[model samples]
Target chain A: MIEICEVGPRDGLQNECKIVPTAQKVELINKLIEAGIRNIEAVSFVNPKVVPPMADAEEVLKSLPKRDDVRFGGLVLSRSGLERALKTNVDFLHVVTTTSDSFNLRNAKRTVDQAVGELSLVINEGTASGKGVAGVLGTAFGCPFEGEVPLENVLKVAEKFLEAGCTEITLADTTGMANPNQVQEVVNSFLDTFGKDLSLGLHFHNTRGLGLANVLAGYQAGVRRFDSSIAGLGGCPFAPKAVGNVCTEDMINMFHGMGIDTDTDLASILETAKWMETVMERPLDGMLLKAGIV
Target chain B: MIEICEVGPRDGLQNECKIVPTAQKVELINKLIEAGIRNIEAVSFVNPKVVPPMADAEEVLKSLPKRDDVRFGGLVLSRSGLERALKTNVDFLHVVTTTSDSFNLRNAKRTVDQAVGELSLVINEGTASGKGVAGVLGTAFGCPFEGEVPLENVLKVAEKFLEAGCTEITLADTTGMANPNQVQEVVNSFLDTFGKDLSLGLHFHNTRGLGLANVLAGYQAGVRRFDSSIAGLGGCPFAPKAVGNVCTEDMINMFHGMGIDTDTDLASILETAKWMETVMERPLDGMLLKAGIV
Candidate 1:
């Protein structure tokens, strides 16, 4: 069995040029919950001035279906964001930093070490505040400004998060640059080092059509949790003309078809993708929505 | 090393609502050849009334850049089509028949057995005239009209073709219904049955986003040749909203990135894909074109 954390509401919506209404975002979350997605990245607690799209993160969280089983999380960039997330009822907090120093400075406005230091406090304080903390290493595969990201750099950041009491660590292909071989190599190293102490998740972008193949590699590497978005939303701003995260429905269909237990209903996810299309009033980047589960 | 027979000219253009002029088709072929593709399915000899897009097969064949190293073939549906191909100076002839009775009857106006019998004549005539002959088993994975295609039925057709002097057989996923397991099973069976006598090629559609995965499966099962299209053009007419064949550039990038040698220039293919996009006046269904080589 695998756990898929629906990041459509957070990572997906963040990249959209058109701002979706708070109510529709809540409805999307409710629909995903109805489709058996209990683990969700519901919001990003970043400054509204920086990313106006996520300004309504608090309202979206408040309006979501209150279920004991459904665990919502907010992605945080700094200590303030983490403090803000601790005030909310969200069950978890995800602190993110890039592996490349150049990308770390450009994306987060902080050096890799500074961001890692900030995330360590986020992890320590959030855990003390009775909330599970997840450490996300973005650009772990490759960086847009800096071409290749060293695997050792990614591993060091992840080790810091693990040492700082992070419950889970997510290795993210922020630039859509990770291939199956590289994904397997990184995932295997993480499992070998921190598999006993920390749970691992993989976040991928479908920009190069290797997203699901990377997922298959991760599965083979004994990592079960993945991050996906409905309609493959969240276009990459750094990479011009890049597509979004892996389509949630397409991943589920492939996994279920492969005889792996995804436990997520594909039909329901398709319906939510349909709703997402309608709300966005545009065609989204997805395979299952276009192909209709053949 | 793997052999990629680009089918962009015949299969990719057959489904286009707009007819690509004969000169443009030849240009596409020339561009593909310049990118290191030696084997190309350059034309189709079906009746112009049935598929008007391929009406200029004779003209296109006449205008092709004749080279000894580059092998071009025409797809023939019936014995008359085969006769037409024989009239041309092409290197090979590919005769096709579907495994599913309903699809065969509807597409070719003949039952599976009747089409196979007719194609046997195609193979005999083409091989007798010193041209390499190939038999393509369409719907070898599954049929849209009929749910599942038995592996025995597909192999039976393949056996008839092999006995009829076909040196190559292509198992085509006509409706994009094949999963990786199915691809592995079918390729394994073909390798087991005609290990010494024949080479096998696998064709796929990207409708379910499993095209690359299927290719990976076929590779693991000991098959090396594959059929792909530039820009992922040519939608399936039977399967509603079905996408096109796997994009040739994307497949090459994947195989080459995974330490498999394709010997094709990635930059040159991307240039051809760009030219194709200009000719079609629309963006194509390819990932590498959007996200340039990382």
Candidate 2:
């Protein structure tokens, strides 16, 4: 069984052009939890002025129903964001940086080294607060700005976070510029250095329509955990694509069809995606919702 | 090395709501030939009264610039359609039948047995005419009408076609309900029963977004020939799903990216898809055309 971290509320809603209300965000998270999603990226601790959709992250976090078993995480880029998340009941703080300093500078307004320094602070703070920390290594496969990032660069950053006591790391294809062979090669290189037991995850976008294909490669290469948005929703607001995130329902359907257990209720997850589509007033890039669970 | 028979002119245009003129149809085939497509399904000999888009099949075939090295084929359902194709310069004749009796009856107004009986005449005529014959087994994976088609049923039909001297068989997922695992299982079963080097082919639709994924599995299971459409321009018009046919450009990108040789010029193919977009006045389902040859 693979663990799927639902990133619909934070990543999916953050990229929407319209602002989703705090209550709806809470409801989406609750629905996901009800559907057996143990870990959910409920909110992003980013600036409200820049990303207006995530403006009510704190309020949404406050409104979440108390659930002892369900653990919710928040994406935090800077130490200030981490400090804010630490004040909330967020079970984990997700630290993000890139293998390419160029993408890091453009994406987070900080150099890779500087971002690693901030990550140390976030990891330490989360450790002090007894909350788990996950490092999201963005642009780990290839960077739009830097073109091809070296495998050594990705592993070095992951090592930094793990050395700082982070629980796990997620390799993200920020631009969806990855193919299956490349995914397998990079995953093999990561596991070769980091050992097989590392709590590794994969984050992919359906930009080039190879999202599920890449996931299969990653699975074959031995990475088990994955991050996906409900309706295949979410793209970077600054730089978007046709769609972002592999549709959770479609991935679940494929995995279930193959007898690879995901432990996700496909019907409930699909209903959440439909609700998300209704709230956003737009059709999502998911095929299962239209195909009716194959 | 794999052979990708361009089906944009036949299977593609046959589904278009508006009629694509004979001149433009010829140009699409010519452009594909220039881009190194050796096999082109240029026309369908079905009744123009029933499928108006393919009304000019003879006109399109006559207008095609003759290249002795390049082979052009036409799809024929009935013996009358086969006679029309035999009268034309079509180098190969394609026969199609469905695995499900219900689909065969609805699609061609004939039962599976009746269709296979018709296929015998098509094979014998093609053999006498000295033209290669290929059988398209529709719904070989599963049928929308029959729910789940048995493997033995699929092979029984193929065995009849092969015994009648059909050169190769193309398994088509007409409804695009196939997943990678199912695709692998079906392909493996076909290969195990039929022997290796059977000249097997795969035709997929992007209806459920698993077209390329299925292609990957088919390749892994020893299928070297594939059917694709330019700009992803075809669908089962009677039962369409967001523009079907696995995008030829996207498939090429994936194969080339993975170091598989597909002896086709991607730049010219993409230009053709772009030209097709202008001609059709619509964006295509293919990702590489929109993503710019990642």
Candidate 3:
């Protein structure tokens, strides 16, 4: 039971400009279901004017394929944003904060303490509504503006997320600057501290080509759930000239080849990603989508 | 002791269409030497027509700066090629063989056994001539033609190279398909078997963007020497689809940032790489060359 949570519809769409028609967004999510991805991040409930790419989140949710077995999630950055997500039928609400002070200020327009406070509120509201809550800590490894984030800072952030009633915590290498050793040590530290209090997940970028290595480190450190974008779409607009997320098909191919059970059809994911690329009208940075995963 | 071994004049040139002027190759090597790269791989002694990019190897060598600290080496694939190298005034000679049968066949047109026989003869000649000898085990991690090369096979080849009286061995991720775990395991096994009877080095490709990961893995496993081309030059003509060696500037940037001492100045190496790029009239693949590692 390998869990691969597709973040393309939310993370990928939000990062780039080529906006897909709301109906086509539903088609892509439905196609992912047809290809057997059970856990897909469908969209985000942010301001339409700010992140124009995800303006049709409500429409995208209304047109889903209606599978009880599959769980759909949406990303949210603030408590007010959670109101929009609560209106939809998303199975989980994902919230993100950063370990670095500068990144939090730059990306979320809040200090780390402020962002964590907001996340706690979102967690309380989501649990009250009987929905899953996920906490994503961005720039957990290193930050471009501020180099070498301390391990203690990350631990404190994770502790805050878990204490705030987050069912799951995702450590994101947001800047794609994490090395293998750092990934192993940080993930292991979290596991040792929290154990079953939270389910751990990884979100990595392929910026310096360390995505697979970081994922391997996370795997060795006992992480099973991960967030990947189809065709490696979605760079942080916050990051200056950043690359996309780890390619979904390539990640699946590597995991499957290593006898890891990732319930993903690599070929079908490629086909769906290709369709997204056609609609986007720009080259999405996914390798397996183009290379076809030998 | 930071040892920067420039492989651009050889590795970078061997895979290109435009033949760099012999004087420019010599100038590039001299500039690297002035910039404090002590060990520079001068050129490869191979058939000129087979690789038109390296056709002026002898002329290029003749024009190199005369410096006692800067030692020059040449790459050769067979006994005959090593014999050709013996005619040059190179400080060292690098002999290459592949642990993977398919890669060895395609790269050098010889089986492992045949390559070993040639290695023994060349080692003897190299030792008698009082020149340093290094053996490069190409595709030590994974092969493009045949993937998932075993650690046992690579270790066995290393044992043979040590037995042939070679002093140094370079474990090459020839296709850049190695993960950090694989690198650590292979390097650990090599260190266990060789026990410093031979020095261990790494040659990596950024094809899959695991170059730095592999390098870090090797370092943790106790390897010190590494081969890198300026601007990440010189793909395998046989495997042109794959990326080439790790960029010298990028490696230096990582090591220097980590407080590890590399004798080469990153800025100077970058400047020399830029000059080489202009001389070769092609795009250089090294990220630091473009990104300017802040």
Candidate 4:
């Protein structure tokens, strides 16, 4: 079965208005469980006022039903957040850094050396606890502030994370500024360096409408795991007009059309996406949501 | 220097509701030329009644100034259209075919073999007279009617056209069904097969918004020549719901951002795009038109 990591709760809710109640977050999680999503990003333990959407992360985590098959994860920006996630009995923690030096400084409030140092700390902490850790290289494609990030910059971040014991690494087209050639070059470089030791995944936004194409590029470059939000729900709040993530249902449909077996029910996912749209009170970025699975 | 090919006259008008006046079409061509478009596809020679937008093809061709640097080409669908183009002083003719059987039948009303046969006649007649003949493979990336056009299918068409003495073959992501992987796979195949006997170009739509990404992929595969419409104008009249082509301005921005010069004026082309948008009475598909070149 093709790996589908549902990032709706973390990446999805982080961009929305009308902060979902903790119980409703639980309801969403329960629904995802019912839908058989094996890997779910439960919440981001960030400041409630900063991201009003995910303010109730602790309550949501507490309300989750412990299932055998599903793995729970959280998105964390710093060591303090990672520590919070470690205490919650989660399976994974996603630590993010920007590949572009300017973006890294602006987004993370640190230089490359500072961000790399923090990543090493988080990776070490997760490994010591016997939990999987993932490093997400934000702005892996291109940067709004910096523009056209060199491939070597992404490679450097990946090398630092891997050296610090990151078991999984995801390259993010954070601003939807990445094209497929850049995706191929970065992915191919990682593969050349780490091979099977690194579990490579992709995080894409449809800012310029390249979400699905970039994912396809990743798949072609031998990445088996992907992160997508239902209804293409989220954008970066800090990243200045960042677009939605790759639509989960559309990605599944494309995969299914290609005879690649992704263990996702497109019909059910589409229905969930409709629910998301109603909750967010916004139009979704997913094409299949409107066109249906053709 | 960016190579700006004005596809607005062909693609931008083809999708409009009102039939563009013959004089307006000529004015648009003149404006694009004034904006410094060295290569322009003047108009298409198809059934006038079927595509009323292109009904005044002969008049439009006649209206253009006889400039050595500015190329005038017509999109030809059949042998009759090529015959008509031959009668005119068109510098070149662009013949297209769909890689998928369904799209070929639906769009061109002929099977691939039959379309190739028709294309061969045009190539033979046009090239023998020292006028350039080019083939554009529609749905080279993916088909809206039939999803996932096989590489073998595109390769077969390219081989047929190359053997028939076509000067260039452009892989078109008609309906924006192309991804970077598909773009690279198809373009690499052409390079491996025909080498330098035929030049490879890419034409992509921004429907699913991989247009620029697909171009990047083609570039990585050693394809230097590319086809883009100004202000992202132009979708196939056959593909009723297809999105616009890759924006000429955006592609130029990408090239300039990457330190590659295409020898075209981006700011002036954008001004021309804005003027054309006013004439067309609609918003263009080009993002750079709204976002401006950063």
Candidate 5:
């Protein structure tokens, strides 16, 4: 069975122009959990001035339904975000840094090495507080500003994350510059370097419409975990020309259609995607939302 | 190198609510030629009343530039359409029939065997006139009305087409109901039966967002030719909930990004897709048009 992490609450809503209410965010999480999604990135503990939509991260986390089957994660980019998350009931902490210095500088206002150094402290603190820390390396495939980030840079960052006590590592195509061939190569390299026992996840953007194809490549290369957003929500505020995250319902539909068990209820998730469309008050990028389940 | 057949004019424009002027249709073909697309399904010779957008089929065929490097094709569903196409300067003829009786009945008002019987006569007539005949089996993957079309039915239709002097066979997922595993199975079966010399092509719809993924599977299974539409234009007017065909520029972008040669200039095709967006007077479904080349 493949695993999927729903990133709608945090990554999906963070870039929206309108701020989603803490209650609505909590409710969306409730709906996803109802759909049998166990792992969800529920909120981001960042500066409110930087991302106003995620200002109520603590409130949203506090209001979540307590379930042993569910895992709620919060994004932590720095010491401040980690501290804020530590005081909350978030089940996990997701620490992110890009492979390219240009992207890391723009996203975190620090170089790649500097951001790694800082996030290492954040990961250690979160782990010390008994939180499961997941390291997400953004622009692991390619960077918008730097064009092509070397695979070596990706490995270096992932090594640092492992050394800093990250329980999981997710490679993110931040601006959707990855193709299937690149995904296969990166996935194989990661598995070869870290061995098959390493917990590896893949996050993709649909900016260029390659999200699912990349997922298929990653799966074929023996990596199973993926990160997606409902109704294709969320683009990076720091990444120019970035679009929505890979649609959660659409990816689930692909998996179910392929006779692969995702242990997720597709019908329930599709209904939630439709509800998300109304809440966003706009048409999102999900194909299943428009075409329905085939 | 892979071959791409631009189907924007015939399959793409046929479903548009607005009637595109015959001159604009010719201009679109000219732009496609400028972008190095050699094979083009230029027009469909169906009843003008049934498909009003293709009312000027003869006029569109007559206005095309005569070039030795380009091969222009016309869609012919029946003996009447074949006769009409014979009167024009169309370089080749594309005869289509679905494997499922439910789809074939709705599309051409005939059963699968009846379509194969009548289209065999059309293929003979087109071949007699020295036109390259390509047999397109629509709903070869899955049908909107009939859930799953068996592989035996697909092979039966293809075998009939081959016996009728068809030079090529293109399997079409007319309603975007295909998965990657299914594509791999079908493509491998076809190639295994027909040998490497068989000219096999794939046509996919992006309704469920699996168009490119299916294309990847087809390619991995040894298919070298694909059909795509500019700006992802056109859906079956008869197929409920059907959306656009796979976008030409976006698919090309994927091929180019993977270091695979498509032999089509992406920048020029992107320019034409931008022009098509203005012609359609709405946002098209292509991702490259919105995100630009990565």
Candidate 6:
């Protein structure tokens, strides 16, 4: 069985031009939970001036119905974001940094080393507060400014996160520049170095239309957890020419069609994605929504 | 190295509302040849009333540059279509039928067995006339109306094609309902039943967003020849909710990105796809065209 972490409300909506209402964000999360999504990155605790769509992260978190079966997460890029998230009832803190110094400087206003040092402290603090802290290495595959990121750089960050008491880590193809060969290589290296017990996840964007292919490669390489957005809603606001994330319903449809158990309902997720299309008031980047599940 | 047969002229433009000029079709073929594409399905010899975009099949074939390095194919559905193709300077005749009876009936106005019986005669005639006859089995994966097409049905069609002296066989996912597991299974089955010397190609649609993933799976399963369209332009006009074929430049980008060679120029293909977008007067379904080659 593969584990899917729904990132629709947070990562999906962060780059949208329209500011979705707090109620709609909460409602989308509820719909995902109803669709059997247990792990969700529901909101990001960032400044309203930077990402206005996530202005109500605390409100959205507070409004969500408490369920033992569900775990809601919030993205924290800096100490200020962590401070805001620690005060909320977020089930997990998605501590993020990138391998490219330029991307990290632009996104978090700090260098990669600086961001890593601060995030290590944040991870310790969040874990002490009884919240699961997951370290997300952005641009782990390649960076727009740096072109091809070194695999050693990605592994170095994962080691630091593991040392900082992070039980889970996610490697993000922030720019959607990853290929299947690279995905297989990275997944195999992680498993080889981390001894196959590390709880690893993969986050991908469909910017170049290789998202699901990379997901298939990762699954073949022994990685189980994946991050996807409803209606393919997300893109990196800081990355140039970035598009939506790997879609939730389409990825689910592929897994189910292949007889791989994702343990999520495809029909229910498709319904949520259709509802999200109306909320966004435009045609999103999902394919299964247009071509119904086979 | 993988062989890609460019199908932008026949399959891509067949379903378009606009009728592309014969001269422009010749120009697109010339552009693809300059980009190192050797095999191209330039035109389909069908009734103009059914597919208006391909009304000038003879005109397009006559205008193309007669280069020995390039092999241009024309789609032939019936004896009349084959007669039309044999009169032209087309290098190959792509004789086609489907695995599903409903699709074959709708597409060729004959049952699968009847279509096969007729196409076997067409193949023998084309071979006697010194033209390469490649058999294309449509809906070999699944049909929009018939749900799931059995593997035995697919194999039976291939056997008939081989017995009729077709050296090349293409398994087409006419409705885009194929999964990776199915692709691997079918490719393995075909290679196991026939010898490794058989020339097998895979054609896929991006209807459900599994086009490239399916391509990867097929490549991993040892099939080298693939059919793709410039700017991802083609869909089955008769199939409900069918979308575009796999994008040429994106697939090339994937193979080249993974250190696999297609021997096609990425920059040239992207320029052609962009030009095709202008020719179609709309944004096509291609991703690398929008995202640029990474």
Q: In model 6, where do residues sit more than 4 Å from their true spots?
A: A235-240, B235-240
**Compared with the true structure, what per-residue lDDT tens digits does model 5 show for residues B62-173?**
8888899999999999999998999998988999999999988887888999999999999998999999999999999899898999999999899999999999999999
The local lDDT score (0 to 100) that residue B167 gets in candidate 3 is 85
- Indicate the residue-level lDDT of B102 in model 4: 94
Judged by DockQ cut-offs, is candidate 3 incorrect, acceptable, medium or high?
Answer: acceptable
List, residue by residue over B125-164, the lDDT tens digit for candidate 3: 8878888888888888888788888888888877777777
Q: What DockQ values do the models have?
A: 0.59, 0.57, 0.25, 0.17, 0.68, 0.72
Model 2, residue B244: displacement in angstroms?
0.9
Candidate 6 lDDT over residue span B1-294, tens digit each: 999999988898986666788888989999999999999999999888877788898888878898998999999988999899889999999999999999878877889999999999999999999999999999999998888989998899999988998989999999889999999999999999997889999999998999999999999999999999999986444454768889899999999999998888999999999999898887788888768878
Model 4 reaches what TM-score against the true structure?
0.79
Task: Return the DockQ of model 6.
Answer: 0.72
Q: For candidate 2, lDDT tens digit of each residue in B26-124? A: 888989988989989899999989988888888888898888989998998888898898888889888999999999888888899999997888898
Position B171, candidate 2: lDDT? 95
- Residue-by-residue lDDT tens digits, candidate 4, B174-283: 77766565666777777788775557778876665456667767776777877878777764334546567777877876776556887777788788889878876777
Q: What would you estimate as the lDDT of candidate 5? A: 0.90
Q: TM-score per model for chain B alone?
A: 0.97, 0.97, 0.93, 0.93, 0.97, 0.97
Candidate closest to the true structure, highest DockQ: 6
Worst 10 contiguous positions by lDDT, candidate 5 chain B: B234-243
Interface RMSD score of candidate 4: 4.3
- For model 3, the superposed segments whose C-alpha errors exceed 4 Å read A31-36, A148-151, A235-240, A253-259, A270-284, A287-294, B1-6, B34-36, B144-156, B235-240, B253-260, B267-283, B289-291
Which residue runs does candidate 1 get wrong by more than 4 Å? Answer: A196-198, A236-240, B196-198, B235-240
Evaluated at residue B54, the lDDT of candidate 3 is: 73
Measured with C-alpha atoms, the lDDT of residue A159 in candidate 1 is 88
Query: Residue A78, candidate 4: how far off, in angstroms?
Result: 3.9
